[model samples]
Target: MHDHGSLPALGWSEFLTTWSLQPGWLLAVVILGAGYLTLRNAAGPASTVKGWRVASFLTGLGLMYVVVASAINGYAMALAWMHMVLHLTLIMVVPALLVLGHPLTVIAETGPRAERAMRSLPVTILVHPATGTLLYSLVIIGTHLSGFMDSMAQSTPLMVGEQVAYVVSGFLFLTGTIGEEKVRPDLPYLGRIALLVVGMVPDTIVGIVMLQTERDLYPVYSGARPEWALDAVRDIQTAGGLMWAGGDGGMMLLAIGLVIAVVSSPERRTKMTGRFLDGVRSARLAEESARGTTEGPAEPGSVDPDSDEALDAYNAMLARMNQQH
Candidate 1:
């Protein structure tokens, strides 16, 4: 085990030496890369899978590997702060990148059968905004409970399961909110902003509670003492602080990005304008109908017969009637 206090001086060579292989992570990367390539090729002459999207997907895969198989993973088992870093990257950073890459869209575009699967009712519900938000919140809150955290840290299999939960929850949260792909219950720009803001509340509460707690929550780290004389309590506090700040900061950035995307997209702007106009028209029609009910409609041809305006109107009406006939 490495000393926590010596974390700063842990050179790249030393970090590389400590790197571990996670077969699951490796397999995921291979599958993701192959899927992207296959989707691109299968998309016919005009591929929707852009170069940047491929890069983004690969980058997400790299981040997952770093959190699971790099030296960071080894240190995370020993240090509370490192563990927090790993969790944040897995849940916040990696998910955002992967969602932006539009993985579901790529899969759907793979073939007719894949498209049908993507459109299934179960998949639709899984990606619904409400379902995703609830599941994400449950995973975050449930896993962070003192007993659960301690149990997970003690068992390697449990830790792996916890990591999987984090990735899945994070992916679900972002799949319908941030990405360009259209999922079930597609939210408007304002709705997406509201969803993000609401989601931040639980994360903020968890962070604050962890930071304020006096006693250590996870006892698994007591045996993994650092040679550099690290203070476990202080490290735990730091981890809580990171969780609080990182979670809120990441969500805020995503919200801003969503706002920018809405503003920049001509199609979105047009749809918003159309909705606004429809609303205005509806309100005006309602007002006119109410007025008509309260009073009464004007008698047909009620204009003054002697006035030039009435004569012009009559002539125009006659022209229109003749043309229709």
Candidate 2:
């Protein structure tokens, strides 16, 4: 007969077990988290285009990433490279991209009595550079420590702690990436640049260590492999490689994206589209004043660049104000 409980260790405690499924708590968290987020959104004023996009991503992608993966793998995924890959993708990629979509702010600030909570100190602190950096580092190092991952995988409590770590770390990292209100305006550009670089340090170290190792570090996996696949050492090393090579690359991408975002602000972008309009306005104003064309058509429909208006009204006003006189 097959020995079900007699399997060998697949390095369950070596951390980086992206295959570790978190079914029960993860499901409850998703259901409740989504509901809470939805209620918060409802408390805000009117919904916005951005808000809709955020909601769509969270409901469609986020829920799937959390529920399905957690349900399938639980804590037994340390041995599965494929599942690890999925876990990392879900933890970092989804969170970062979803944050880039800016769903929370869209739902919170643009909706009705939009909660000021998002802008509150507690929220801001959660997304601050310090917080993101700490969360990212600890979630990686603390969880992966041989003792922690092994011990935790063995019990329900530690397993749940793992869940909390991943979720909170992910949330913080993404929020830091996408938030402007949580901006570290006081931080010099170079400082922000260095912060990101520093954040990648642990991941780089972990990946390098894994790649260099010849054997599996985690003794937690109690299962055997197909032999053609990775042995313990190779798997552990590959986990490192995945972090350093892949994670470092991700950090670089985020840096590039940030630079692009800064340079591509609407105000900065407006130079291209608004330049001709402004120049034409200046020329016409000079011409009309010289010609005494009755104080320039009263400019009654002129839309203030600083004011908010319906798209229709704004477009209509802009068209009228730029009339030849």
Predictions in order: lDDT = 0.74, 0.56
Residues 1-325 of candidate 1 have per-residue lDDT tens digits of: 2234445334578667777788888998889778777786787766576878878887998889877898777777667777888888999899988887888878788777987888899998888888879988888778765577767756778888888888889999988678667434456667778889978987787788778867777656545646553466776778888889998888999999987887898666443334455455444443433342556643433433334644554566577679999
Q: Which stretches of candidate 2 lie over 4 Å from their true place?
A: 1-26, 29-52, 59-80, 101-107, 110-116, 181-192, 222-229, 266-325
Give a tens-digit lDDT track for model 2, residues 1-325: 1112432344545233434454665676477557646654664555443555455456535554553454234323444354355446655665665555455555465443454665668866877878888888888777664566556546757655665566567656656554343223334334455766886887777677667876556666524333444567777666677777777887788778767765777553333224456555544444433333455442422533333432444455566678945
In order of listing, the candidates' clash counts read: 0, 28
- Over the full model, what C-alpha lDDT does candidate 2 score relative to the true structure? 0.56
- How many pairs of residues collide in model 2? 28
> Which number leads on TM-score?
1
TM-score of each: 0.79, 0.62
- Candidate 2 positional error at 309, Å: 32
RMSD, one per candidate, in order: 9.9, 10.6
As for candidate 1, its clashing pairs are none
lDDT winner: 1
Query: Looking at candidate 2, what is the lDDT of residue 40?
Result: 45
